[model samples]
Target: MVAVKITTVSTRLRRSMRAHDDYAVRVGRRRLLVTVTAHPGVARRWVHTTLWRHARRLRSVDGITVGMGVQWTPPFRAMKYGAEPRPCTLQLCVGHRCLVFQLAHAGAVPAVLRRFLADARAAFVAYGVRSDCRKLEEHHGLKVARGVELRRLTGMGNASMERMQCRS
Candidate 1:
């Protein structure tokens, strides 16, 4: 498994961050806390471990909606010819942090991520989310896809789209 991780290079991710905190992401608008991932590495393993470790807390959300975006590469674009197109950049937003899952194959997403996403949908107070459940299942192999559109409560509206960055 290649694993998946989210780094806030776009939006502001901060929580009680210190001036000298190595894990701190930024200063000012960004609190720069390791609140997102525990291990704080440039690898997806760390993200998986952190989320897995805190699964209980994550699943306990009153309501969680994730904003998602898709990207198409040269190969996909070449075949598109203005076709319906396919998904590439899979971005998911919870609060201030956006977890951009740059899938090698959107349809072939890792089982663990699918599991977490499903759990988040079930636990979060997304009872009011009106999403394309059918489309999500057909394309992403999951019952629900979370995002700013998914989250009417605290998402950055359309800004969420521009703010989310593909974890490089």
Candidate 2:
């Protein structure tokens, strides 16, 4: 038997809401403070500090949880004719902090983000991570040097898991 943990974050925004917001998300048994923003500066600062903190603590950064949302092209006549999906949002979670970047509003991808993604020492963890990395490369020219796919780790194939049970 195997046990897998998953976390989800959700929030409703008003019509006149600001570009940045904070929410508490539960990851496993801990509550994480997540910041959602469309500003490149804020995202860069957070990633910079996070990498610095991890470097000072362990000399290497790893176990970064990553998730992304894509805007699919409209389906008209045939599925094959539809344009490739465009990545809209990227979310990263580490320790008690999570940062959600709205890529559409962020304009260009930040230099810090590019460096972070390209860092070989930093391992990004996600389900179907290869596709995520591919999208980043294809859309933003960002290369992710290392990543760990949870689906492969758990041997779960393409099945979605909300809650996993383990037998000891």
Task: Return the top candidate by lDDT.
Answer: 2
Give lDDT for model 2.
Answer: 0.69
lDDT of each: 0.43, 0.69
Per-candidate Cα RMSD to the true structure, in Å, reads 11.5, 4.9
Runs of candidate 1 exceeding 4 Å displacement: 1-28, 31-47, 59-68, 72-83, 93-98, 105-107, 120-136, 145-151, 154-168
Q: Model 1 over residues 66-125: C-alpha lDDT tens digits?
A: 444444454623553544333444544444444445444323456665665566443333
Instruction: Report the lDDT tens digits of candidate 2 across residue range 35-83.
Output: 8888888888889878876765435343444443334344345545534
Query: What is the TM-score of each predicted model, taking all chains together?
Result: 0.44, 0.72
lDDT: worst 10-residue window of model 2:
159-168
Candidate 1 shows a clash count of 12
Backbone clashes for every candidate come to 12, 0
